[model samples]
Target: MTTNEHINSGEWPLWEIFIRSRQGLDHKHVGSLHAVDAQMAIENARDVYTRRMEGVSIWVVESKHIHASNPADAEAFYDPANDKAYRHPTFYNLPDELKHM
Candidate 1:
């Protein structure tokens, strides 16, 4: 069914899918799909996104539950970090023996 049809029919809620590749340490948003619940969403994600078995893990969350900061508010939201110079690694002095750092 088309997206509009699904919405109008109240079939299922949209879910956001995230996949963690076998070689990756973090899960990244892949795409979205409509599912009846979280369990179905994960299963559907595996079938749709991991057809090549490239992903080691899958995460599915209801789209409505995902909240994000607006890009227009980025300047105000992240401005506080700019004033904290001490938070930068360059602000600290590393010992000569700390080669790994």
Candidate 2:
């Protein structure tokens, strides 16, 4: 059967997987997979993504739970931030000894 048929047939739901590599500080989206539940999704992600023993942690989130901003509304959505110069680090003056700053 086609992918749509499988999904509509009450089969496993799609899950988005994020993996934190051993050397990484944050989890990055690796790929997606279909699983019965969250527990199964994590296990499946480990097997599929961490087979090479590269990942230190795995996060599985249901596709439906993810909410993202619309690309078409980018200007309107982020325009407010541009006016708030204080929110940016460059707006402030730092001491000369603050090497990182």
Candidate 3:
């Protein structure tokens, strides 16, 4: 398969895709598959993952390139802060007439 054209055509590595079904919600990891290029990856992800209800947007990243932190560093990775009130906008009273965030 090394020197063959057929195998060479399928050389592009696999990728994992994430999809955002709607606004205001975090992107969720959908699944993974192979493609010849990035554009094909997106199209393939749509045909494979979202053939039914579908999503608003899609993201495709090479599965081999994803770097994740060790789970053993959980405490140091995501620690809660005591004075993070400013990070949240809950105290501000937004207009009730507004339809979207």
Candidate 4:
């Protein structure tokens, strides 16, 4: 890619785009694209990902800012959340028949 294509393809990184389909839920990863600046990233992501009325809010994250768990650390890291069942809303067991998830 050209310098105009991104800031630092491997280091400075590309940004990810997220959008909220509704007001009550967290924004979700819709897609990603690179740009020289955040303003351009947002604009580009909006046009590229949200061409339809698929979102009400938008969020952008420089790819580096996100810290994903390494596959090797899966058990040592995410295992705690699993043990701490309180972290989940298991108390409210909704039947599959429920309309709203």
TM of each candidate vs. truth? 0.77, 0.74, 0.57, 0.63
Candidate RMSDs in order: 4.4, 4.5, 5.7, 6.8
Query: Candidate 3 residues 47-78, lDDT tens each?
Result: 99888865878899977689999998887766
Highest TM-score, which number? 1
Any runs in candidate 2 off by more than 4 Å, and if so which? 1-8, 79-87
| Backbone clash pairs in model 2 (N, Cα, C under 3 Å; residues 3+ apart or in different chains), count | 0
Clashing pairs in 3: none
- Candidate 4 local lDDT, 41-91, one digit each (tens): 888888988788788788998776889879998888877787677767867
Model 1 CA lDDT for position 82 = 88
**Model 3 — TM-score against the truth?**
0.57
How does residue 8 of candidate 4 score in lDDT? 50
Order of candidate numbers by TM-score, starting with the best = 1, 2, 4, 3
Question: How do the residues 1-101 of candidate 2 rate in per-residue lDDT, one tens digit apiece?
Answer: 44456567978788999999989999999999998778989999989999998799999998878999899999999997987888877867788888954
TM-score of model 4 (CA atoms): 0.63
* Residue pairs with backbone overlap in model 2: none
Backbone clashes per model, in order? 0, 0, 0, 0
